[model samples]
Target: MAGILAWFWNERFWLPHNVTWADLQSTEEAAFPQAEDLYLAFPLAFCIFMIRLLFERFIAKPCALGLKVQANGPQKAQPNAILEKVFTAITKQPDEKRLEGLSKQLDWDVRSIQRWFRQRRNQEKPSTLTKFCESMWRFTFYLYIFTYGVRFLKKAPWLWNTRQCWNGYPYQDFGIMFTHHIVTVTLITFSYVTNLTRVGTLTLCLHDAADVVLEAAKMANYCKCQKLSDLLFLTFAIVFIVSRLGIYPLWILNTTLFELYEALGNFPALWVFNILLVILQILHCFWSYLIIKAAYKAIAKGKAGKWNPLHVAKDDRSDIESSSDEEETVPRSKAPHSSISTNGTGGANGTNGYLTGGTCSEEH
Candidate 1:
């Protein structure tokens, strides 16, 4: 009787204060021996951290190493000092006004300036694989905290043991799980159809190139940074296109397959439903194309070079022509002209007339 009373007191008061895996397991073992399976449930925080770490170490790090090699390697050589200068300038002038001033001095277009500003404001703007890995590390740290909160609620004996927890309330958890499953499956399908994995890999390369360009812009008094930012923007645009065109169709196909399986007994009804879904999917594809087209047009305007996927073109010719055109089109105001008029009559006879001469002018 004493042990039972003590256990009840511990569960109500002490359990809440010292909530841990061990404490949760002990409570489950003592109160509901048959419910031992629940005690084995790991915290969501653990899973999130583990996944984040794995992605950072396995995926992001390798990409960063490859980028470093490319940047330093013989094929494309860039001065280290120039790169450092550009990065330093960006870091020092983190504000938009400073960026604008820098852009004007560098002769970069507004679109490039906007892109640089956007990147600076983002919490995780990874230009290198190393930086990406670091960002992932930070993201995982925050994700762990978020998961910890969820796990806390799940593990709380007071909540889980209550009758209110089991009846109909668990539906919310089911809904969340279902949504997560759907999103994950959709993303996976999108990855396969759009070849997003390949694009994502390319993005890492583009990001590195942008970083180098950013660095170059800072060193020289030019709009070179704008070109880098534009490249990054273009990469994002391509990724968006892939997601829309490739992924959406796969999603429709998946949904159709599901409906077919669900309505096996009612073939005609399933056929009609499938047809409607197909129409809706086609509409969705059209809408996605419109959005992608608009975005592509917007980003393309800021491009500095040929922007051909299969070609290596330089921006030098266009840049030189634009610079020359700017010089000719924007007229320089002539320096203010100063005029003076003086008259002297009969200086020898000044004693008699006492003539004086003065000059006056209006200033505008």
Candidate 2:
């Protein structure tokens, strides 16, 4: 184990040439970040989780009520052991062939079976108030984090000039890193170990700013405030694009990829960190494409005067397309050749979408 640890901590890989671990050691006057500090984060996270529960109950729920966010109770499907078994054990949405077999077995028409499935699916969806609370919780966190981040960064030179981030190179400042699981987490963990927290803060701050708008849009959407939702969604798209595509690569990536190299010279771990940033940038581009596509579709629909409240700002990555209420009104006899076509109705509770998170970094 010690041999493996020694090999992994080789100074040549992690630090700049000629800088040994001894050189990076903390003294009484200059205390460095310790890995043990991370232990506090777990307990803090638990506290936050508990706070979320209370916030959702006391704060968000009341706010949702004030906004008049209606919670439509789902219609329960009549009890049927066979269909229930199929829904639970087999598929929520059955294929055409499976539908036919079930139709024959139950001696029921396809339309009735389809309605049951629709009702069944709706039953599984969260209540509109529940979705509102969840979005509200996220909005509260993102807004607070963004506000705090802005305050923190106001005095930090690198907030204005990215190049200043590398003025002291690796030794003069402490920093943070973040990312998804596996590769992203590895990047974050390595970056934190290397004391790269400054850039990490920028990445996190940029991300939370956009999410604040996204969650607000979701909350507005849940309340059926179409105009507010659409406006907020447009704002979210702009923020997402500017932060993820515009500033992230131009400012953050530039500093990390170029300025850092110029300041500290090449190291194996630095190359690893750069590769992870590039990967994150690629993800940004992919999600940006989704946002652009959604925005274009919204524009075209608006021009054509085919505005759908349910579909307003509906990007599946950011929002899921709920099954329409109008579908239930269609006569059972007029049900499409494929019941599948008529089956996708949004649940009674209005959580009609999802949003991906940002930030590819680790903490202090």
TM-score per prediction, in order, is 0.24, 0.78
lDDT of 2: 0.66
Candidate maximizing lDDT: 2
Per-residue lDDT of candidate 1, residues 1-364 (tens digit): 9999666434323221223224323342242211222222344445756776788778756754654411121111122343235555664223445433544554543333333332232213222233335443543443443354345435533233332222221121211111111123333333322212222222122223222322222212112233553454355445444543555345434533463244222323334434554674576466546545544654567534323211111211111101111112221222222001001111223211122111000000
User: 1-364, model 2: which lDDT tens digit per residue?
Assistant: 9999999999899987767777656776554455555556666777778999999999999998998886654556678899889998864567667767876677665656666765665666566677789889988888987888788788788899877766655465543322211113566566666667677778778878888888887777777766777787778888888989998999888988898888888989888888999999998888778776766777876632222222433422222223434245232443335344323222233222111221100000
Candidate 2 lands at a TM-score of 0.78
Best by TM-score: 2
